[model samples]
Structures are given as C-alpha cells and as structure tokens.
Target: MKTLLKNGLMLDEQSKKLVKRDILIDGEIIAKIASEIEDEEAMQIEVAEKLITPGFIDLHVHLREPGFEQKETIETGTYAAARGGFTTVACMPNTRPPIDSVPIVEEILEKAEEAGYARVLPIGAITVRQLGQELTDMEALKKAGVVAVSDDGVGVQSSKMMKEAMRKAYALGLPVVAHCEDNSLAKGGCVHDGEFAKRYGLQGIPSEAESIHVARDILLAEDIGVHYHVCHISSEQSVRLVREAKARGQKVTAEVTPHHLLLCDEDIPEPNPMFKMNPPLRSKKDREALIQGLKDGTIDVIATDHAPHTLLEKQQGMERAPFGIVGLETAFPLLYTNLVRTGELTLAELIEKMTRKPAELFGLPYGVLAEGKVADMTVIDLESERPIDPSAFKSKGRNTPFAGTYVYGWPVMTFYKGVKTWDQADIFVTFEE
Candidate 1:
C-alpha cells in the first residue's frame, strides 16, 4: 500500500523547508519526498498547514509491565506514547519483576511485539533485582533484545558495583543509563531539600545526593571507557558536572524532563501529591541551569520519565505518596507552549532532542524523515490549543500535576512503521456527531 502526505511543512534540523510536498510511503519505508508528485493511485492526505516531522523517540519511560499492570501495561503505555507523538520508547526496567535476567527481558520484548504499538525497547537491570549488590547477566540480556542497562528508580549505592556494571556494559558495547542518587543522603526524604521543604516542616532530599552520584558515574565511565547517561537530571551541580565531563572528553550524556525544566519547588503549592516526584523539583536557579544546559548543548536529550501510578497511591499525603507523575501526554504540549513558543528553544532544536538526537545516542534507526527511512512519523498541529485533561488519557494511570493547564501544539496523527495506529480524535472522541 502506498500513502501520500501533502501540504505540510517539513521541519528538520539539517534543512528546514516550507514547501508543499508529498511523502510517498511504500510498505514501511519512505519511498520518496518531492514536490508536485503526480501519483494517481496513491491515497492523498492533506495536512493543511501542519508540521510533519520524524516520530518522537523517548529514551526514558516506565511501562510497568510484567508486574505493575495496575499502574500501566505495555499496551496502554504505548497507546499513550502514540498519542503523544512517540513512535518508539526505551522503557526503564524497574518493573515489578525487574528486567534483570534474560527470561524477563525476553518476556518484555515478546509482549511489546505482541502489543504492536510503539516500538518498546526494554532496558536490562544493572544489578540483580536492582538491589545494587551484584551485576546481572549482561551478555544474555543483551542477546535477548535489551538495548541498555540501568537501575532506575534507585541508583546503585556501591561504587564497586556501578564500576563493575559499567565495565561489563562497556565491554558489551551498551550504554549504562544511571539513575543518579546517593541513597545514603536521600534517606526518607520526599522533596527537594530546600527552603520549600524547610518551610513545610518536611525532610528534604539535598541536591548533592543527585550530583554526587552523577559525578561518580562520570568518573567511573571515564575510567572504564563506557558510555554513561544520566537520567532525569534535576540539579545545577549535576548539570555543571555533566558540562565539565563533556569538556574533559568523557563518554557522558544527560537528559532533563519537562517538569524539571519548567517547574520548581517554589511553584509547588501546599504539599500536593501530584507535584511530588523523585529527584523532586528543585529551586529556580536549578531550573535556570537546566534550561541553560539544554541551550548550550550540555544536555543531549529531552525525555519524559513518563512514570504512572494509581490514584490511590498518589492520593496519599505528599510524604507517604509514591514518587513520579505521568508525562507522555503532556510533554510535547508543555514544551511547545512554554519553551519553543517563547523563543527559549527553536522548533528544530526541540524536534532534534525528541527525535534524531535520541536515536543517534541509543543507536536506533527510526528518527529521521529521509527517503528509505522507516515511516515512523507524526503530523502535529502546531497551532492547536487544548486544555490538559488526565481523565481523557489513554493510559490507566493519570497522576499528572498539569491537569487543566492550557497548551498548544498537539499531535493530530501518528504513524508507526507505515501503519496508522493512532488518530487522536477518531479514537478518543466520545460524541459521534
């Protein structure tokens, strides 16, 4: 089957063009990209002034399959991803069973393949059961289709264990995505250890807790000659460390979330559980540092940590509630409305972080719009306005802090591997008329 998309602006960092063109898709590859293509048998799609770009790729997401289905399943999570314009996502292995072994990794891969929505790449756990004691079967897991290794949700406490994991992953030619946090310093803390926490009479998690682990991981990666990636960076010190590490020619990369870049602890009002997340929102200065890091190219990508939890779990008091908020459905709108529209980042740069940069970093082959590339694409209505509504979400978990926020620029349609899997209004609208 051949599909032709016309009358859309192609936004690519390498070459920005605003011409009326048609993208001819033959099977699962883009057959051609040209102006005034006369194909009488092709199905024509008029985008009518939308922006067509390569599908977004999120490097950090929690699908909660195999164990925590109540929070999210692979099917539901990928549906949410498709709605959010992501054609591929690298899932964190902090599941109920924890993707620590070859069997577990294979199970996730099989399930994702069966689900058949967004491409799900399972990350293998760095340590057995993520206990940070001993490394898992890295080679076997890699053979089972695991793209990377991590102990997300909790950082490895022992430098010895982390160094060993890095060494094994380095030898295997896989990147180690580090969840930077010093458990010793983060003991029983719920929010950022700053004036907000002090004023609320709650124990705060210090920024040093995050930066210390980041610094250690960078040095370990340098010593072991492995690729190290920092997840959900939320501290100025951590950003500074990553900048310096890059300058020193270390194989280190970092990602920041939308919440960490846009919101701060000062913006949290009255201990709301929705606002609660691990590596909790930091001070304004830290927020500024994250923005600057993205602008200066210190941060390599923008990922939606996209953690989902039950309403009952999030309803608990801020101190007792689980850490994390749903991000997939809101990431693009929040970024476009706040950052790109405000001149903080160019549209090309934003698309680059969401697409090509992540694929290049992770060694994936699905984040570009060139001919002969995989036809994973998203058509975005850059001027479309909408209010954030968690109740209308595709995922089972709707524990976001951005509910009711007005935002612009949403994904209208998403195609995965030449198949139209998600058409938002067609799939989501309740009223037939």
Candidate 2:
C-alpha cells in the first residue's frame, strides 16, 4: 500500500528554509515529492507544521553486544536509534570479543537483522581484538560486510602498526576511523587539564594527550592516502590540526560530539561521573573553537559517540567511573535548542550535518528525500518543548547529563524503508480528508 504524508514541511537545502511539500512513499522507496498531490487510494497522514527530513545517520555508536549485554544490546541500541530519528547507525567494535574477524562481524549483522529497527552497520576492529598489536584482515573484513575499520575505545599506539593498517585499508578503499589518544599522556586523567580539574585537585588529561595522536594520524593518513576520520574531537589544538589539514587539501575528516560542542570542563558543577567522558570536556575556548569549526566547515559532521554504561557503573566516583554517556536520544534536541534556535547554527545547517553530511562522508545512500530515493525519513515536532527524561529512552542505559534540560525539535516518528519503525503515540495527527 502507498502512504501519503500531507501538510508537511521539508528543509529546502538550496533556499535554507522550510517549504511546504507532500510526499508519497511506496514500499521502501519514495515515489514522489511535490507541492501538492491527489491520490484516492493512498493512506494519508496529516503532519501540519511538522518537519519531514532524511533520517539521521550516526557514525560512531556502541551497541555493546556479543560481550557487554548489560550495557546495551543491538535490539535496545537500535531501538534507541529509531526513537532518536536515526535510520542507520555504524556501531563501534569494542565488545568482549571485538569485531576483528568475519565471524564476529557476521554475528553482529545477524543480530541487527533480527532486531529490525534501525540499520546497524558494524565497524570492524582495526587491530585484532583491539590490542594495538596485530593488524586484522582489512580486505577480508570489508568483504564480510563491515563499512569501516576502527579500534574506537582505544587508539592504536604504534605508528608503524597504524601506518600499515591505513595502507591496507586504503588499498581496499575503506575509511580508517581513529580514536586519537596517547595513553602515555592521557593515563590517570579523568577530566580536561584546566581550571575545573585544578579547582578540584584532580588528575587532568592535557590537550596534547589527544592532539599529539591526531597530528600523528593526520600525517600517516596523508602518506597512506586513506580516508582518515577523527572521532570525538575535544581540544582546540586538534581542531586546528584538522582545519590546517583541510586547508592543505588533505583527504581527512573529523567529527565533534554534542557533549564536546555544548559543554566544557567548567560546566561540571562537581566531580560527578555523569559528566565524565573520554577525552574529557575541554576549556570554554575549545568549545568556542568547535562551534566555529563547524560553521567554517573545518568539522565535516556531528557524530554522537553514544557509549552506554549501566547505572551502577556510572554511579561510581568520577575517578573510577568509566568514560562515556548515552547520547543518541539527546543529541538532536540539545543541538537544536542550544545551537540552531539560538542562531548559532541555522536549522538547515544542523539538519544537513546530521542527515546528509555524514551519509555523504560514509557513502551511504539514505540521507536524501526525493523521487526514487529510499523512504528513510523522520518526522520532527518543532513545537514540542519538554525536558529530556532518561526513563523514556528506549536504550537500557540511562547515563546522560542532559536530564532535566528542556529542549525543542524532538523526533516524533521515523520510517526506515517505508516501514514505520517508531511513532510517538501521544502526538497522533493523522486525519482523513
């Protein structure tokens, strides 16, 4: 059966404004998008004043399956992705038995298929078991259906090993997603090396800890000529290096998380674990640079490093707690309310970064709405203003600092391949003519 979405607005990328349009979807494909449509046999739904957009594609996410089920599983994580208006998510390989081999990659794909919520693209571990020692079979991993290769939880410490991996991935036309960090410089640090750590007398992770590796990886990627993508940029120095690289016309890209862009070290009222994250929050100056970087096109996309941890684990002290926070649910609203609504970033710009830019970078074919395109779209309630509640999340983990924070632009419904994967029951607006 065909579905007609009437009285909806889609972001006009060229005009930089929301324009009224109607969409007709026919079984996994968008059949038409026009100013007006008349279809007697179609099932129509009214979406007055609502925004229809391409589904967001997340590049860095941790499903925590095949090992860490207590934190999150493919079913729950993809369910969270669906609720977050994401149609496709690329999960990092940081489980007990890391996705280093074909068997592990196949298993993750199978589980995601069974769940059938959002499309889960597994990122293969760059090094076998992510030990930073032995390189995995890049060609084989790609053949086994992995989109990218990464050892995300930790960085590859050896330059020689990293260079070899990049060369192999480049030969196979694969992207090398890096978690740039020098353990030697970052060890024993829980927060950024700034006033916040100084005031609390806590160990701090310096900018060099992350930037040094970023600088190193940029050079390696330049030499290897592989698509290099930096993950979760948090420091001013790292942003500068990427900006310079882009200026030099290098084949490099980087992503900044919402937490890193919105909050800095000073925002932490206390040494609370909720604010704890890897590459910890940087100075206010760094945050400003991130916003500028995004505006100036230095940062190519915004990706949520959605790492989920159990309540018991996150409740541990700041010094001992694991580094991460659940982000899939709050990323859009936080950025929408704080950045777009405040006039820092245009609504079209934010939507482009979250939807089309990431998909373009990863070469996925799901982030555009037009005739003959995939019917993967999201319906957003621009008027729905409410506080973010963790209890309402579809994921098993409820570890976020954005709790109690009010925001706008929540995703009310999502469709993946013409399938209604998620719909907000409270905001039913469907009506017959």
Candidate 3:
C-alpha cells in the first residue's frame, strides 16, 4: 500500500524552523519527502495544519504483563502509547515475576510482536527477581536481547551487589539503569518531605532517600566505567549530584518525568490521592531545579514513567495508596502546552527531547523521520485545544492528576511502520479507487 500525506509541517533540525513537506510512504518505509509530491496511484490524506515528526520514544514505562495484567497489558499499554505519539518504549523489569532470565525477556518480546502497536524493549532485572540478593546473568540476558539491566520499583540496597552488577554489565556492554532509592531512607514515607507533608500532618519521604542511592550508584559507575542512568529524578540534590558527575566527565545520564516537570507539591490542591506518587511531587524549588537541569543539559531525556494502577488501589488514601499515575496517554499534550506553548521550551527542543534524544541515549533507530526510514511518525494538532479526559483513555488505568486540565498539541494520528495505529476523532482519510 502507498499513501501520501500533504500539508504537514516538520521541524528542520539544522535551522530549528518549521518547514512544509509532503511525505510519501511505500509499504513500511518513508519513500520520499519533498516540498511537493504528486502520485495519482497512491491514496492521499490532507493533514490540514499539523506538525509531523518521528514517533515519540519513551525510555521508562511499566507494562504489567505476564503476572499483573489487570492494571495493564502489552496490548492496552501500546495502544495508550500510540495515542500519545510514542512508537517505541522501554519497559521496566518490575513484574510479579520480574524479567530476570532469558525466557521472561523473550516472552515480553513475543507478546509485543503479537500486540503490533508499539515496539517494546524489555529491560532485564539487575538482580535475580529484583531481590538484590544476587546479580542476574547479565551476559546471558544481553545475548537474549535485553537493552539494559535495572531493578526498578525498588533500589538495590546492597552496595556490594550493585557494584558487582555494574561491573558485569559494563563488561557485557550493557547500561545499568538505577532506581535510586535507599529503602532505609525512603521507607515508611508517603508524600515528599516538604511543607505540603508538614501541613497535612503526614509522613514525609526525604530527598536523601533518593539522593543517597544516586550518589552511591554514580560513584560506583564512575569507578567501574559502566554506562549509568538514573530514573524519575525528582529531587534537587539528585539533580545537583548528577550535574557534578556529568561535569567530572562521568558516563552518567538521568531522566525526569512529566509530572515532576509540570507539577510541584505546592500545586497539589489538597491531600487527594490523584496528586500522590512515589518520589512524590517535590517542592517548588526542586521543580525549578529540574527545569533548569533540563535546559542546562544536566538531564539527558524526558520519559513517562507511565505507571498505571487501578482506581481502587490508588484511592486507598495518601499513605496507603500505591506510588504512581498513568502518563502514556497524557504526557505529550501536557508537556507541549505547559512547557513549549508557555515559551519555557521551544517546539524543537520538546520534539528533540521526546524523539531524537531518547533514541540516541538508548541506541534505537526508530526516532528519526527521513527518506528510506521506517514510517513510524505522528501528526500532532499543535493549534487545537482540548481538555484532558481520562474517560477517553485507551489504557486500563485512569489515575492521572491532569484530568480536567485544558491542553494543546495532542496527537491527532499516529502511524507505525506505515500503518495507522491511532486516529483521534476518526479523522478523514482518503483511499484511491
């Protein structure tokens, strides 16, 4: 099948300017991109006024499959990802039976291939069963098609265990992704250790909880020469530590979630569970630091730690509720409107961070839009406005705090490998006779 997309705008990387282009797709590859194209034999679609770019890539997300399928599954999660403009995502290894062995990793791959929505990259657990007791077979896991090794959802408490894992991963050419939480420091806490927790008379999770582990992991990675990455960075001190390490020329990288960038603890209207999340929304100062970190090159990528939980589990009160919120369906519009439209970040910067930067960081070839490349692209309505609605979400979870918030730059349509995956409003598409 062949299709031609007309009247689309793409950001020129070299000049950082929006340029008009017509893209032609043949089978699964972008056959041609030019100022104008005419093909009577091919079906054509008019995009009206929309921004076209490579499909977004997310480096961190949770797809609860294999054991915990109620909250999310490979099919539902990828549908949410496509709706949000993500074509490639790297899933964390925090399931009932964590991705510790070759078989589990292959299982996820098979499930994703069967789902046929988004490309799912499985991350292997650093420790067997994520117990932090013994390192998983890193070399074997790498050979079995794992991208990185991480014990996400919990920190590796044993420094000795973590160092050994780092050594093995480095030798095997695998990056070690750290969750960065010290159980002793972060344990028994609900909200961030800030004024909000104090006002609500609730327990606070100190910044030290995450920073301590970040510091330790960075030091170990620096000495052992492992490619290290920090996940869902939400603290001021952690930002400072990562900044210092990058300054020292360490192979350190960090990711920030949209919730941390878009909302702070002070933005939490009340003690509602919707506003609750692990590494809970931090102080106003920390939010500022995170933004500055992104602008100043201290942070490497922006990921949707798209953890989904059922409303029943999330409504269990602040202290008792689980630590997460659904993000895959709402990340782009929220960030584009709040950051890019507000002039805090340019359209190019946001797209660069969401697409190219992540692909380069994780070493994937799916984040570019050009001739001869796979047609994994999306068309976004940058000028259109819509209110955030969880009811329309494709994922099984509806635990977002951004519901009812009006936003712009929503994905109107998504194409993965030249196949239409998502079409908002069932927009117009023309087929030739």
Candidate 4:
C-alpha cells in the first residue's frame, strides 16, 4: 500500500530548520521525501497547516498489564499512547507478577502485538519480583526482548545489590533505569516535604530520599561505566548531581515529566491523591530547577510517567490511594502551551527531547523522520486549542490533575509502522483533480 502525505512542515534535523515536504510511504517504510510528490493512484492526506515529525517516544510508562489489568491493559495503554502522539513506549515492570522473568516479558510482547497500536517495549525488573533481594537473570531478560531493567515504583535499597545489578547489566549491554529513592529516608511519606505538607500536617517525603539514591547510583555507574538513567527526576539536588555527573563525563542521563515541569507541591490545591506521585511533586524551587535543567541541557528527555489506576483506587483519598497520575494524553498539549508558547523552549527543542533524545539514549531506531526509516510519525495541529479532560482518555486511568486547563497543540493523527494507528482530524482521502 502507498500513501502520500502532502505539504507538511517537517523538521530537517541536519539543517536545524522546518521545511515543507511531501512524504511517500511504501508498505511499512518511508519511501521518499521531497518538496512535492504527486501520485494520483495513491491515497493522500493534506497536512497543510500541521506539523509532521517523528512520533514521540516515552522512556518511562506503566501499562499495568500481566497483573494489574484492571488498571490498564496493553490495548488501552497503547491506544492512549497513539492518541497522545507516541509511536513507541517502554513500560515499567511493576505488574502483579512483575516483568522479571522471560515468560512475563513474552506475555507483554504478545499482548502488545495483538493490541497493534503504539509499539510497546517491556522493561524488566532489576530484582526478582522487584523484592530488592535476588537479581532476575539479566542475561535471560535481555534475550527475552527487554530494552532496559528497572524497579520503577520502588527503589532498590541495597547498595551492594544495585552495584552488582549495574555490573551485570553493563556486561550484558543494557541500561540501568533507576527509580532513585532511599526508602529509609522516604519513610512512607506521600507528599513532598514542603509548605503544603506542613500546612496540612501530612507526613512529608524529603528531597534527600530521592537525591541520596541518585548520588549513589551515579557513583556506582561511574565506577562500573554502565549507562545509568534516572527516572522521574523531581528534586533540585538531583538535577545538580546529574549536571555535575555529565560534566565529569559519566554515562548518565535523566528524564523530566510534564507534571514536574509544570506543577509543584504548592499547586496541589487539596489533599487529593491525583496530585500525588512516587517522587512526589516537589517545591517551587525544585520545579524551577527542573525547567532550567531542560533549558540548559541537563535533562535529556521529557517522558510521561503515565501510571494508571482504577477510579476506585484513586478515590481512596490521599493517605491510602495510589501514587500516580495518567499523563500520556495530556503531556504534549500541556508542555506545548506552557513551555513553547511561553518561550521557555522552542518547538524543535521540545520535539527533539520527546523523539530523538530518548531513542538515542535507549539505542532504538524509531524516532527519526528520514527516508528508509520506519514510517512512525505524528501529525499535530498547533493552531487549535482544547481543554484537558481525563474522561475522554483511551486508558482506563482517568486520574489527572489537568482536567480543566486550556491548552494548544493537539495531535491530529499518528502513524506506526506506516499504518494509520490513530486519527483525530478528518483529513485523509483519495487523490483527485
């Protein structure tokens, strides 16, 4: 099958400019790209006022499949991803059985293939059952098609265990994506240890809980020369550590979430569980630092830590409810409106972080918009505006804090592997006249 995408504005990475071009897709690969291409026999899509680019990639996400299917299934998760303009995502292994074994990884892959929306890559748990005790056969996990290993929801507390995991992962050529938190310092706290927590008399999770572990993992990775990636970075000190680590040429990379860049503990408004997360929304100062880190090249990627839970689970209230918010559907609009339109980041810069940087860090080949590359792309309408609504989300998780906020730049369509996976704008038709 052949389809022509006509008159779309695309970023030419080598030239560092946006150029208008026509893209031709033959089967599952981008066949050609030129200033203009006409094929009457092929179906065509007019993207006159839209921006076409490589599909966005999320390095951290939780599909909640293989165990927490009630929260989110692979089908629902990938549907949400495609609607959110992502073509590929790596899911965290915090499911019921946990993705620590080869069988679980295979199960996820099979489910994703059956779902057939965005490409789903499984991240295996670093520890067996994520118990932080025994390692989960790193060699076997790699062979089972896991791109990386991480115990995302909980931190691996044992220093010796983490060091050994890093060593083994390095030997097997996989990145150690760490959820940095010193459990002892964390103390079962739910909200950031800041003004809100103090005002409400709630137990606060200190910044040290996350930073201490960030420091430890960076040190461990430095000694072993393993590629270490920090997940959901929310603290100022952690950003400083990552900045210094990069300065010293350590193989370390970090990602910031849209919520962290946009919200702080002070913005919680109430004691709602929707506002809570693992690393927790931090102080205003930490939020500012996270933005600055993205501006100055300290943060490499912008990922949606799109964890989903049932409405019942979220309605359980702050103290007892789960720590997460669904983000896949709102990430781009929130960031584009607040960051790009506000002059904090250019459109090209934002797209690069969401697309190219994550792919390069993870060594995947799905984020470039060049000829002969896989035809994974997203077409976005930057001129239209809409309000954030979780009820309309494709995922089962309707737990988001951006419910009534107005935003611009919604994705109009998404293509994965040359197939139209999701479409919001009625813009495709057979070529005529």
What is the clash count for each candidate, in the order shown? Answer: 0, 0, 0, 0
Put the candidates in lDDT order, highest first.
4, 2, 3, 1
Query: How large an RMSD does model 3 have?
Result: 2.9
Candidate 2 or 4, higher lDDT? 4
Which residue pairs of candidate 4 clash? Answer: none
Decoy 1 TM-score against native: 0.98
lDDT score, candidate 2, position 373? 97
**Which pairs of residues collide in model 3?**
none
RMSD of 1: 1.4
**What stretches of model 3 exceed 4 Å from their correct place?**
426-433
Best by lDDT: 4
Give residue 210's error in model 1 in angstroms. 0.3
Worst 10 residues of 3 by lDDT: 424-433
Residue 331 shift from truth in candidate 4, angstroms: 0.8
The residue ranges of model 4 lying beyond 4 angstroms of the native Cα positions read: 425-433
lDDT of 4: 0.92
Error of 4 at 353 (Å): 0.4
After TM-score superposition, the amount by which residue 371's alpha carbon in candidate 1 deviates from its true location, in angstroms, is 0.2
